[model samples]
Target chain A: MASVNRPNKQQNHPLDDLIRKDRIPHIWCPGCGIGTIFASCLTAIKECVATGKNGFDLDKFVMVSGIGCSGRAAGYVKLDSFHTTHGRAIPFATGLKLANRDLNVIVFSGDGDLFAIGGNHFIHAARRNINITVICVNNLNYGMTGGQVAATTPYNAKTTTTPAGNAENPFSLPLLAYASGATYVARWTMLHTRDLTVSINEALSKKGFSFIEVLSPCPVNYGRRNKEKPLETLKLYQEKSIIKNGADPSELDIDMEKGIILGKFVDIDKPTHSEKYDKLYRIE
Target chain B: MTENTTESRVLTGEHFMTGDIACAEGALAAGCRFFGGYPITPATEIAEQISLRLPRVGGTFIQMEDEIAALTSVLGASWAGLKSMTATSGPGFSLMMEAIGLGLCTETPCVIVNVQRAGPSTGLPTQGAQADMMQARWGSHGDYEIIVLAPSSPQEIFYQTITAFNLSETFRLPVIIMTDEIVGHMSEKVIIPEAGKIETVNRLRPKGRKDRFKLFEPDPNGVALMPAAGDGYKIHVTGLTHDEKGYPVMTVEAQAEMMARLTGKIRNNIDRIIQTEELFLDDAEIVFISYGVSSRTCLEAMAMARSKGIRAGFLRLITIWPFPDDQIRALAKRVKALITVEINLGQIHREVKRCAEGKAPAYLVGHPGGTVIPPERVLAMAEEVL
Candidate 1:
């Protein structure tokens, strides 16, 4: 039998320079929204590098991620990156930023890593207004650990640990960020890649602590158990999400029934941790 | 940039200082520009002292939310091209185990000072104990080797802190300064040498082409050259078992290779890492092995035994880990018996016994560690062994 010869075509990914080419075929599953969110993050980094905004350069960026499926982003990114222990990406990034104020430290991790075990560090980092950007992928469950319930899991959601439906209310991450004194807070679904990229780019340029919540779908672990396919989840996000800039953070909780509020809720300039530290301690 | 001229980074000449404060000054003198720690008893003085001194030296001191964060932040700062450190007691040291493993795996250079307090859990925060000696050896879960230095006095601790930083940088792993609450709290005369007299070691930086660099590839010295975060190396550091390129490789072969590098660095360089002080061992019939504050008592007991016509020799371990097996083995063959004195209930005694290989019987003059072991008890034990 003769094999048919297909047209041979080779193309370079647009973000090839930013991605670790050898680490391709990433651990992210098919139809997983994390890949989309990661692409958006890289796109923002690419834009920032092209514009050289605030002296932004590829050499000056460092990515830190904690343990989870999304935490693998640090491994895939072609930056000076750190794949730290579970739930400690924020503190690690804080130290990195404080040690070298010239570097732009970005923490990319999952909700379970950022909000559950790492809640104290997250709140404290925000309270101090450390000059770092935190991009949290909220998949509503612990995807890496087999669809276990997470701190951000929606009320009455089905998970491996919450088979009888979740009885506890989930945290409103934007509200938490606002209460914790984050200078910049925003939320966007993976479907809103353009908006999310823009928000990430803005947060990178902003001084002080910036947090962005990315609503992503975990199909194999989360969607399969909830009777929602990846495409169905995207459709739900498209249909249910309402973009409300400067909306009250308290109303930004994830409730599909009440409509999901998205967009920049808080954006204000403030002295960052390094700035305050230098002001008080670096006196000549 | 503001020049640091208010206080000399190295406070030269004689000054009465606590071991905790001396450790802090040692850190400053050794180019430690970043300290991330939480205030814990017995160890809190180190943080307090560093907090006041670091700013004047144009360094940073951060009080993290917890000990876990404290250690992790120190690791972060180390990777960002700073000689970084943290200090804590028993409970805090327990919380820092996982991060210590991360530091080991990533081959990050930093110093961890554990001012030992009695503890199963919060045992005696204000009192000193040698209970953590064993914990310092195997506290972090894994197959790895560590360099630990036990200092007996404020002067020794100050010198050892500098040595700790140098060893950490040389080996590219976290070096622990295992001092106790007694030594940490007790004040004594410390002479800080001039800055020019003190030697500091910085991590080996990568040279040649940056793109062709493999972050974990060892040099001839069995240590990999490290590049800081913004050095344009674009390296990936992970807690996962990784390849020479610093990328995670989840295979047995990769695991073996990584483990060999991590452990081999210290094991191969054990002779250079181990330090001990010997007193009157030339023709002694009985030998005493001790470290940290307990060695002080052992020294006194040795003198008392000598006065009573018992030929007692004292061996003080300056470096605790890499266990000085060869030294113990040789000493075991030469001496009649080994008396191990420590505040803990026979931690290092077990190691001494193992290394002794039944050539010499090892007996422990141990205490549960609320207070220091009396010299009379140690002398009595030596007489009985004789």
Candidate 2:
């Protein structure tokens, strides 16, 4: 079904057409990791549209977002997209998916939107194992609003909201996703764009709730304010991230000060929320 | 429309019934193909009936985990071009407030049947009340207009269910069928109309260039044409304040203009939306205006008053919100007194009195919460006004 509708001309690429050229000189300053992550997402979405299992219908694909800079990714996409209220993209997408079951609903959210204000929905959607892919963009601080410390912000990282340093501990999104019963959980940095794209493609292919947390850089917000340039932040992630794939869940100690880990963490089969609902409500 | 005696006679058979059950039959007859709901009684029977019947008819029925998800799924189904609905009581309805707002903002046409039970917070699940009348209007977080209908009998439940869907599609807004537990759970003989007899409303679509089309841009009529998904229109839809193109706009100027368009469509066209059934109101010394189950008792009391040579009449409001103020105000001028009969202390009665103004003396016949007010009590209030 997907091949039947493919455009013969390269210029007619739907995914490429979705990107707004005028809005370029990307929102983040030079060396910021968001641009790289965005590229990876575009690649993943393109691949899904190309070789999508069950003839990936573009009309059935919807993107839901919240109120963070990462959430703005939905706006850049040329599909049925919704930028919902703060911390509400997951539930909104949940509704959109259940409404059709044919739609491939994706949620684009930031750390603050997913783990802080919208934490409850994230955990529940994971637990329910709804068949939607959630790509969480972790840029440490609230970039869109101001330089405010977030739930994923590194401990002792200074920001406008946390003057001296962030006193609170941060979270491990992949570990949380694993605990919440997500069928697939992975983490990658924007620096590893190819790897991130591969991870996204893998998540999009799998059934049930798949979560990918990408560590992006907030050059304008946290990066510059912390006196770290884009390259320095990328180096910091490189030095701190552990490459321990298939690591034991109990053995992993995600330190607040330590940088993000990058790799596929969990992949398992579980009955999706809607499928379970179908079983319970089998017609007489 | 020719009345189908077969359908009417068959549906009038004596049977034990609940108001929720009657609503389910009403929805089926009204062409409801999708049902998404969380079980909340005295409204659970509606879900149960849909679960059983939908599959038989090749329709979709889902029992969502919560009321929020239930309403959300219904909205989604509606966008997929299905006539979708959900039913809930006070508690579930409260949970649905946010999604209800989403439905309003997106202009997704769907029906929400609130089998209203007493509540401020689980006040009385098994009991009935006319509370939440104001909540239905202002529960959501934004400024928008909605159509709300109130029905008094099993017959009204079936008919109103269909009318709710029609109004939702006709106006491109979320429509609420507000029925209390008394009317929802009561089993009464209802003459169901045949398929062709019932009027159905479908959204208008634009022809010509899809790129040239303006979704939110209305013509001389207030309603803009709606485009369904898969139509290849490149339509952009959002919950945020948007221009006619349906793209989000960030200026106050844009906000004011769009809000005006949305609210004005309903306010300016109130006459086309407001519905009220007038009975003997032309020449009466006293007029009793009521809705929901209370209005049924009001009718019986009005009949008893006429037998006693008391000049009294009744106005049964079919549409609650977009209150039939013009007609009520006119009735108040002709009648010596206007009395409101309702359960719950006084919610819509306030609206009635506000519309009545100084045209006549207005009084209330209030029932505390759980119990229904018999016809005699309302008659006493009418007698006092007379």
Candidate 3:
């Protein structure tokens, strides 16, 4: 039988040991940054559970996913998890949280699911700041089915669907989350696993909607289209990504020539969507 | 407690009623503490009545921005462990389809009433139609099952609302009350039975430590014991194709098993979930199969056909999916012909045809949402097909 109490600082919960090490040579192609993002999530969950004085109950958490390669991360997790329809993970997680206010709800989705099909839910959930964590793995393209142009695809990035180059501009997720009123908003790359893990832990500990965007790699879809290998992609992210220790989110902006700046962009206080709903309903 | 006599009851009179009002009262009697909805003509009365009555009983009610938000808010309330519901017409229901799928995949038990009107897109809003029957079954893409109940009278709406919530809780699946404009607006006396007498279903929760809990772990009956958030259970649940332990499984074999279990719950329990009401069919040569308000016309036309010496019969669908295949097939074998009468062009008629499958010819009598198909029209179709 598994222990239900919070874990002590020296011991990690069973979920930490559930990751298949043999599969450690991740299926993600060399240079793809997704491997780093995946590692950060693993590291964060392990540390969160490890710090508990008693074993962290794994059953009280649910990880939700939407359509995209990043969405597949929910499958790799050995926890109560779900991989739902495209752009709809926010709502699905909302349902799970509503079903039981105690479940630690987390969403791992692709840019397409978050900004395209599920844009409404993303904004409303953030505006409502429902007590859930959303980690958007932005590879700039729809990596799963094919490297089709996605809402996050950089303007002028070549995709299978974007023959001449993407005409539409991409959404700055950190800015969007900040504007939509997420209590916690941050951005990091697969290359910066340690920092990302710290940010992820902080986001997870927050009581309101916490959003983290991991700039990942799409070796097959986004990478191949750009004629970049996995390592080259990671190199691009590491070189092009502007790192600021604690950037002011309102002042941060992406430079096409420089690339996305990665850091904790926003962390503020407001009533979480659930808290407001609780107050509104006057639930004891 | 006093028996609900006409003068003493909440609402009284034996006039013709629509399914919508019955659903509202049924919800009230079922201990529904919260309702969040937007005003869409066919489903407007449900929100209207719930808003008016919920306050009297100290239940919460809100008119949300749209159907998507309506469902989102309801899901929010449901987590607070309140029995919650929402109602909508075509376009609103379409917007809600995504959330409905979410509810099912996550095993969140909540009731949604769709007073279907015509459309691929808002074809008719003010009028009535039963065009969404198929959408109710497979509108969301995935290998999951849904329970949809169709009511023929205002009386059945009251009864079915309780049944809808019960089934939703029992199976952890979204239960849909399929009605249309005609049934939604038509009013009649529905017996507001004593609240305690009406059965309500609650999800089974695990009793042991949160450490040993597997949110999606199957019980003896294959349904997982649902632990709400505040239960102190560390349970993980997701909409992805997951193993019995509730962990998402990426393998094709794992996906196949998960899909099968998700679908098989409803298939195996069809006898328990599927319901119907047959009338004047024992000695009839032709059977008119209908549901929602259309069934009323079928009954009227069947009576006229009997008067004309045609020996016609009627089959009223109380449960639309699982599609009443067994009974329809049995009747098809015995009848000379079966006519599926509905507001849409031929939505359920296709099902009737499939069930009949050469045993008898199935005919369709439809009126696109604008006008109700008159009883005489159904009579003509019955004569032609039979």
Candidate 4:
């Protein structure tokens, strides 16, 4: 109450230059973790741009996202962003990157967007080792559609569509990425911001399909039905997640009762799709 | 391997080529450097020929997982400042409808070639049919105008494909080349002009301050100058109803404005977009309206009707969309009757009847589309109408 009538001041965020200021006061709910994950992505991009490592040009950074709550990330970013049709972001980004090899394309989408309807594109892109960074925000449910059961919804989790508790098992994203031949695969939670940012930065420097699964909270949709608050989710992430670097991808499934294996699971070199195309098709 | 030269790129001489191969060469000559496609019957040859030729001419060809990916990739490549194309049949064309709507909403310039096959869900895959004509007009679930060119022969497909790329660039939307299985596989003499002799129109690039540029801001022609991804425009493009700045604005007024920009471009420029070929319509009493492979049959029918003293005129629709309403209305005012000939069962006939507005009696001479409608059936329809 001391300075309730004090003059309002305009404060700028550090990542304001990278954001579309007019589009803010974003659609993300209060306890949602997408904002933090998005911040980490911008931070990774900033770091890559500053270091000029791996030919990361700010002008050449294009953000592509599919339909979901997180798909709106493409609209919020000031970079050349495309909010493509649902489940087609990877193929769209594939076209953009393959058309102009100079551009650095990153697809930022949600778990429902990346793994559910877009699963085929995800696996094929990883198989081809396309040079792109895909950061999937795993929010465990279809938060945009009011907490419906998603492909990544935890087993026995109560959702709008699965109010009796889900009977389906969730996808182990890192395991899928590894099995699909992703050159770089990692998993981290929003609570692990430093590790997530570093992993994203490392993925950006790599030259093949790099996938990083970021477990984010959809407290309003997921936590309320699961009888867990945002703080409780964060606590579980802190206490139950084990930072096991280079762990076997098969052992990286998320189990709230057990432990979530978090860290880089796969990192190997292979010729990217473009490199192979050039080698086979382009003769000087 | 053929030498990649300006000559090789244009293939600047007359050659006997299939419609699919000629279409691919036309794309190459029109500066289409990226093709994203999936193999479907009757259209697979386009993909095959492009895959073999595109790489040699410094182009990229990707066989996508499905038609959805194929068309979406084409849209993405187009936004990256490449003239992109995709070829598909009825099944694949159906799969591409949603992406076509996306392409319209985002004002992306690309070419979609639909080599028609009979279909109501895989009806006839290997045979030729013109059943998808109506689908081509109203395939995508939206209130947007589209440019569709119906090329009847291998040579016509070659020239029309180049025109398709030009029109797409000029209007900044996906232009469709609606050739059927008959024309797609038919081999004929296609004249390939030298690269310099061919006129290719490129999308206008934004000039002046990059920061001040709005992505969806239309010029006098209702088309905005486009900038590529790495051009530092920092543009945001979405399928949502967007403002001139390409930012999604969820309001009725925003929807109205965006719709105007999307639909106005084609409506205002209909004169330039609509192309038709007329034969002996000056003083004829009866007229026959047709397009694509069916137009070839209509021509033969008109000649037969003329021999029988029926005074039948032929009107071939080269540009099917925008419907040539003005020409139809005027012809309806003068003619006694209009006979619509197509392989499909009375699709364009309905459009002709609507435009005729009961001024002239419109009858359809159509088949169920397993095979082409013979000229005798069309001539019989004309005599019965008379």
Question: Which one is best on lDDT?
Answer: 1
Query: What TM-score, to 2 decimal places, does chain A of model 2 have?
Result: 0.89
Per-residue error (Å), model 3, residue A161: 2.8
Model 1 C-alpha lDDT versus the unseen true structure: 0.93
> Candidate 2, residues A1-284: lDDT per residue as tens digits?
87988877656544466563433444556655766787788788788788867677666677778887877776666666676666777766766676567778788878898889888778988988989999998888888888898998877889998899989878878878899899998887887788889888888888999998888888888988888887887787778887666765544444536644567879898889877867765444
Any runs in candidate 1 off by more than 4 Å, and if so which?
A1-8, B1-6
Please tell me the TM-score of chain B in candidate 4 relative to the true structure's chain B. 0.98
Q: What is the lDDT of residue B335 in candidate 4?
A: 93
Query: What TM-score applies to chain A of candidate 1?
Result: 0.96
Model 1 chain B worst lDDT run, 10 consecutive residues? B1-10
lDDT of 3 by residue, A48-130 (tens): 77786234455565677777777767666655555666676786577556545667778888889889988888988888778
Candidate 1: docking tier: high
Recovered native contacts, candidate 4: 0.78
Q: What is the DockQ (computed on Cα atoms) for candidate 4? A: 0.82
Task: Give the runs in model 2 whose Cα sits over 4 Å from its true position.
Answer: A1-15, A20-35, A141-171, A219-231, A250-253, A256-259, A270-284, B1-16, B205-208
C-alpha lDDT (0 to 100) for residue B41 of candidate 4: 93
lDDT by residue (A1-284, candidate 1, tens digit) is: 24456543656779899999999889888888899999999999999999977999899999999999999999999999999999999989988988999999999999999999999999999999999999999999999989999999888889999999988889999999999999999999999999999999999998999999999999999999889987999989999999999999988878888889999999999898888888887758
Clashing residue pairs in candidate 4 are none
Q: Which clashing pairs does model 1 show?
A: none
- Residue lDDT tens for model 4, B273-350: 999999999978999999999998988998999999999999999999979998999999999999998888888899
Query: Regarding lDDT, does 1 or 2 come out ahead?
Result: 1
Please identify model 4 stretches exceeding 4 Å from their true place. A1-10, B1-7
lDDT (10s digit) by residue, model 3, range B1-386: 12222222134334345567678778877767778788987788888777666655556676654687678557655654677899998899888887787677667778999987778787878777888998898888775778999886688888899899888878777799998877777777676655556677777777877667777666666688876554555334556666776665689998887777677778888888988887888898998988888888887898888888899988888888877788888898888998889988888899999999979988888877776789999888777765
